[model samples]
Target: MEIFPAVARVTFDGQVRSFDPSVERTEMERGLPKQRLLNSQVLVKQSMTLYFASIGDATTFESWYFDVIKRIGWFEMVHPYSGQTIKARFENGALGDLVPDEKLTGDFKMDTVVEYMR
Candidate 1:
């Protein structure tokens, strides 16, 4: 199996951007390099101090984040589009290679932090 190191940044406004240093076209074409590698896509959602929103409610915002990560091209699966059924392995980390820092302010702040590792 090959390991792809990635960095992602998420802002308070629900803007997310990602970068992967070891990602390449060949690696992406071959997917996650496991015969039984799970097929999944990464979906990111954020909740501010007073509001909650789902991916369906902000498709364009989610797409922007997805696009940044897709540039890394580290998976061997088809790209997922809105309303499309696709599978992809999920992974998460922060940009700058640091562990994510989270704080609680509201009733559901703890639930706001999400991470997926493949």
Candidate 2:
């Protein structure tokens, strides 16, 4: 699998991570709901907004995403929480939108959502 191209020069900001635990639950009429763990492993999903100081870096990422990542349908990236290289796919199989930031001088921004998979 191809690894995702890095575009961020510094830290990844505005990142949101969600953990979906496998579970089964049953509602009781007179008492608290009962739940059981279906699997020990939890699914991870992340949404990140990346900042690029250089337009060249942002364009590089866009080219890689279209040429490689889109074709492969999945890629490897370092998980922020786990700090390990993990296989990931674009959330809902959609490419992120790259736009120039007017608020920041000579900067670009892109937002992406990815789901980690085994």
User: What are the lDDT figures for the candidates, one per model?
Assistant: 0.29, 0.76
Mark the 10 consecutive residues where model 1 has the least summed lDDT.
106-115
Return model 1's CA RMSD, one decimal.
15.9
Model 1, span 1-118: residue lDDT tens: 2122212222345324333223323334655742332334334322211121332323432343356444222332222223232233234422222222344232111112222222
Candidate 1 overall Cα lDDT vs. reference? Answer: 0.29
Worst 10 residues of 2 by lDDT: 5-14
The alpha-carbon deviation from the true structure for residue 13 of candidate 1, after best TM-score superposition, in angstroms, is 14
Q: Compare the candidates by TM-score and give the number of the best one.
A: 2
TM-score of every candidate: 0.18, 0.77
Candidate 1, position 66, lDDT: 57
Model 2 ranges off by over 4 Å: 8-10, 102-104
